[model samples]
Target: MDMATTTSTATHTSLASVTLEVADPEAARRFYGAFGVDTYIRLRASETHSTGFRGFTLALTVSGPATVDGFVAAAVDAGAAVLKPATKSLWGYGGVVQAPDGTIWKIATSAKKDTGPATREIDEVVLLLGVEDVKATKQFYVSRGLSVAKSFGGKYAEFTPGQSSPVKLALYKRHALAKDLGVPADGTGSHRIALGSTAGSFTDPDGFTWEAAAPPAPTPS
Candidate 1:
């Protein structure tokens, strides 16, 4: 079955924010503030206050020095494990943190004015598929009217359909990909990723899954 057809049934929402675990909330806050996110919320648990904020929210995060310490403290107290302690990255005003769930969070202090190169807004979503045989998988996609955009070290390849908005359908070897993601190689089926305009999924050789989907059509303004 062509699983890509099912993406239309999925919800279409713009990515708002993501919350992660922090070892030292205060440190995380400081680090993230320096990176560019502004923290507008903080909660604490104490003897007098057995109850605290019910859920996490980053809607008001911004960048600044004044709120950094508090933000980091709050994050740690809420159960985040620090991955990379706050430090400058080579690319820009940002720091990397691995949350308790193994999600990597990149906190930035300032937007890089000199990104060095101008690129188009992603017209296509890239699906990182895990496969057993790269050549066979490429043939499947090619038969479906997709063409290769590029190949990464001969192991990973990206394919794009001619009629679509230049979105990519990519394939990678399962075991190798799992190692790259630091995840155990036991999972099967596909994981879904959404973009602004289209959606699709790919199943690779070892039964690893990947998806790239575009959002639903927009409503009239």
Candidate 2:
């Protein structure tokens, strides 16, 4: 099969939005939107649907140790399942939380390995793609015009987004991600999220869906 490309393909530098089809959009909105001004929760595509890992994760990168701790604490307090408690790693200090929406969040701080007092701001946010075949998925994105910032032994990879790139993207082995989340590696059924890009509508090698962002409908006078 041919690689799918969008009609109005988003540039490598645009922010991509994740569209989740939830049983209760209102509940999703209340929970997700509270995290930040940018995070959004909208309507579902269908009344009947399924939900799971969805092959992606929401990463909140912070510069302060307090910020990471605060974020982690807040996530847990807000009904998130703690996947990994706050700790230090090669990349820096960080932890993982599975939000109520089934979106896994990695709260991290590369600036300091030590914990500190609470801070309110975030350094950056990234959308991480978890796939069964890390190497092949990395190749697919590379072929699609994205450049890599760093890479590891066919297990982890990071891509540098153009200045205009909306959301920073990365790739990780699905099983490894499952291990991180403390869950079974096997995930199936519809991913239950839609991505709209100026780049256009296309399906990835892993079955994640993307479409062009539709303009707002005109209101009647």
Candidate 3:
């Protein structure tokens, strides 16, 4: 792998979008669109499919269903434990699965949100982690007082540590996560986890970085 030549054009904040390399372009498009996300770009040969949002983008690329199946199989073959086999959800179209790395992937339609006026109030912040082992990582955090909100398989998982003000910490396999971020997997540990309040840092089992942050204090009334 070329180390020095790594360049990323993707510029978005939070947990942007998890891109899955699949087999069918149209099917993947329709699958995500059904979740209410608009498909902005589609490329056949490059197998690139992109969905746009006000602040982020989710992408998928595949030749067809068979190809997607093969990719899933490859993950399993590579020692990735399936957290959830690819299956449809009651809420909408798409499927959910986990990899051995504790990365949970939801290959579903875009999530639909009720229209509302924008406010200064924060909605959510996404935390990303690269781990050597997903299962062990999940256990480490859970033992540290974090609660598992959801687990897909060995590939990915999500933990929520708060209620009124929520935080989402996601764990992903190093290599697959590198591909999603379009970067190299050699740099493990917390790449960057954001918090909505006072900024604080925590280290996971793999020495990944994590943050608990808040906006700067405001002037007294």
For model 2, how does the per-residue alpha-carbon lDDT over 1-221 read when each residue is reduced to its tens digit?
23322222423523345566766666665666555523432346345344455677777877766788888887777677888898887777888887676767788888665456677677777777778787787677666655677677577777766463356777788777767766676666777777655566777788877677554334337
lDDT (Cα, tens digit) per residue for candidate 1, span 1-221: 22221111222311211223334455555544443332321212112211211111111222532233333444455445543344443533333333332223323344334333422111122334556677677655554345566655447666543343332345677666555434455642222112222235554344333345333334338
Write one digit per residue (lDDT tens) for candidate 3, span 1-221.
Answer: 22121112221122212233434545545443432222222212222322211111122223333333444454455444443354333543333334322233333222232244322222233445667788788776665455566676677776543433333456777667655443345532222222332224556666543445333334338
Error of 1 at 126 (Å): 2.7
Question: Highest lDDT: which candidate?
Answer: 2
User: Candidate 2 — what's its lDDT?
Assistant: 0.67
RMSD of 3: 16.6
Give candidate 3's error at residue 14 in angstroms: 17
Candidate achieving the largest TM-score = 2
lDDT of all the models against the reference?
A: 0.38, 0.67, 0.41
Q: What is the TM-score (0 to 1) of candidate 2?
A: 0.76
TM-score of 3: 0.38
